[model samples]
Target: MNKNIKHILIILALFASAYNASAKDYLITDFGAKADAKTDNTAAIQKAIDECSAKGGGKVVVPGGEFASRMISLKSNINLHLEAGAKISAIANGAKYTSLVMGNEVQNVSVTGSGTLFGNGGKFTIGEEAPNRPYIIFFKNCKNVLVEDVHLLQSASWTLRLFGSEHVIVRGVSIYSHANLNNDGIDIDGKDIIITGCHIDSGDDAICLKSEDSTKRVTENITITNCIAASNCNLIKMGTGSIGGFKNISISNCSLRRATESPFHKWADKPDHYIGIPISGISGIALEIVDGGVLDQVSITNITMTGVQTPIFMRLGSRKNPTGSFKNVIISNITATSHSRMSSMIAGVPGFNIENVTLRDILINSQGGGTREDAERKVPENEKDYPENRIFGWTIPASGLYVRHASNINIDNFQVRLAAPDARPALYLDDVKQLKATNVKVDGEYIIDKAVYKANAVNTSVNQ
Candidate 1:
């Protein structure tokens, strides 16, 4: 085993031991909760949780039945445990929204069970706008949290969001929440977190990490492994909200693909010819630093992506703040198959160049049909535009990868294949400095132009 994996397993094992100390169990049925699917069990379940917390920390058990509720809040040192065949469905109170489960300023809390949480998400929306909809689970400013072995489906919005928290673990969770817009699988903003062995299919970004403007806490020391993520948007993304920044993040052994459901929002393009078909995800893995944050020390490896718009995209934009930095990123052992006009990209602003990036052992097969006019197109520097795969107008000049305004980039054993013949370069570099390429095989041409300096190329082949 790798040393990093071994150390991470040891740390996870030690963390798991802390949950076994609480042994008391409090059943919700004893607190006037009904098993009927129509009864409002919000107060009953809350009372049971309150009693359990009042008598110190314990497990508030929900047995095998369907309970309908409005909001369920979890307190400190409490575990919300559900048995097999247990189900909690959120009631549809139109125009009024409350999270189905929320924990605020709590510690040593967990929600674990082989059960299901269903939000009647379709009833809360009106004409593509969900004015008021409930979140499935939202935790804020919490510590030592664990959410495991639960089935989350049809969430109103953002299935599980953790903000300004630490020491979190989410494992064996299956989320299918395509019933509404902005229904992200998991939005995490914390430190020392691990997300493993989960399957997510969502309408928006799956397994996203962000540091919003509401807190000063940076999202750091996070690990995501052995997960399958499918979405209409990005599969794994860090940013779109980069207030405090991200650091020391690692992702490995993951699969990315298109969403299973058609989208509810117009952001996902479903053309007239492909009306009912599921569109590929926008970007397989995207990293953006747009809101004045430092993004450093990110490592991604052993990833497989299928049917994505762009396999990888890294951007440092000046949307909200122009003082952000993006550096020290390493990606390796990646295989991807994409079908889009837009290409993988590494972009930075004019004055702030992305620094010290490495890509090794990458193989990509794209459906390329670019024309010569596309290759001769002048790309613009959209410094303040919204950071997205197609933000700079679609049909990128390069068919394989496009790099601009970056420095100290190293590429080794990088290969590209095309399904259709393209009259464009396979790799295009603009204003890039200190670029080193080794054993790169391109299907078309490789061009370095416009302010590129000191680039070293060895064993680079075209149409090989």
Candidate 2:
């Protein structure tokens, strides 16, 4: 061999040896961490993580035991691997860490294994007036992060939030957080994220995407698929916290249903108020650009929903700014059963219309009891108010789908039915233009403005 090649080969061997040494596992128990569930192991766990990171990068292993901690901060190039049967219980009170586990401005970090992280949520106060509680796992400004195959339980606040992070993947995780109010399951507020094969049951929104004003991060290029979400609030939602907006997002092959437990139902003092029977969820899917931001290029398909108040809700309202843009959204292959009288809505403010939206291959089986007086009642333009399906009223003018202040809308292969009779129109469109429909079948009337209706280009059938 040439002398230069031999020297290079020797250098590569040394590098590999160093890497293997640095990547060894450092057990938390070896660092004076007791796992009897009584001792606070915050310092011991942090010590292990700090030493592992200082030596380069490695796995900080939490062995099979019940360990109590306040909060633990993770470092770059470190993996917090929880062994199976290991349970980390958060301390009941803490003023130090706002989150049970946090990583800020870190890269190549991961929390992977089949262990459990339990937040002592029952110890915290319930209701919106209660003090702010700590989040379960929060990573801010992180890159190349992975969280997989872990069970997160009983979070006081949001569970598994990634804010202003990129190149993140959260897969095959299980989350159950019904302890208190605002216990969202997974919140993604970043770009280039993939969240797949997760099961989430929460007291609030199950899978939510947000770009809050404080972050100013455009949540773009995100994909979510093959997830089961059960929530008292929205199963899948975007915004109500938008400032930099959302773009190029896709969600498919997801299941949405009501939460199993409604412990703090409507912030009541009673726990398990809706026992034996879970209440219907607020919405299966909701998209709202209430704050000043643009929501564009979103596609959702192959979704199934049950036990939800509303199947779909899209709103463009003025919360902080006067107006925001919601356009180029396509939702298809949806089958839903809504139990409430409120209709699925696609609405915008009076002056600003949601544009270029399409709904195809959709079917809704609604529990309809809309009276004639309900159909004739005028819907309010609550443009500046908070966006929700019941914001307009309990019974919208339309029994199946209600659309207003939208333009260039298309509905194809759509059908709506009721378990009982409904006096309201099955589909209602107001202040809409460039409307197109094909193979549309409704059990009741189709109340559409002539200005927005296309004669031959659209086909519709109604049964009264």
Which number leads on TM-score?
A: 1
lDDT of 1 by residue, 380-400 (tens): 888888888888767787777
The runs of at least 3 residues in candidate 1 whose Cα sits more than 4 Å from the true structure, single-residue gaps closed, are: 1-24, 126-129, 265-278, 443-464
How much is the lDDT of residue 370 in candidate 2?
67
CA lDDT, every model vs. true structure:
0.83, 0.83
Q: Which runs in model 2 stand beyond 4 Å of their true positions?
A: 1-22, 94-96, 266-278, 443-464
- Of candidate 1, the 10-residue stretch with the lowest lDDT total is 450-459
With a 3 Å backbone cut-off (N, CA, C), the pairs that clash in candidate 1 are none
lDDT by residue for model 2 over 361-454, one digit each (tens)? Answer: 9999877766677777888897788887878877787777788888888888777877777777677777777777776666543333321221
lDDT of 1: 0.83
- Each model's total of backbone clashes: 0, 0
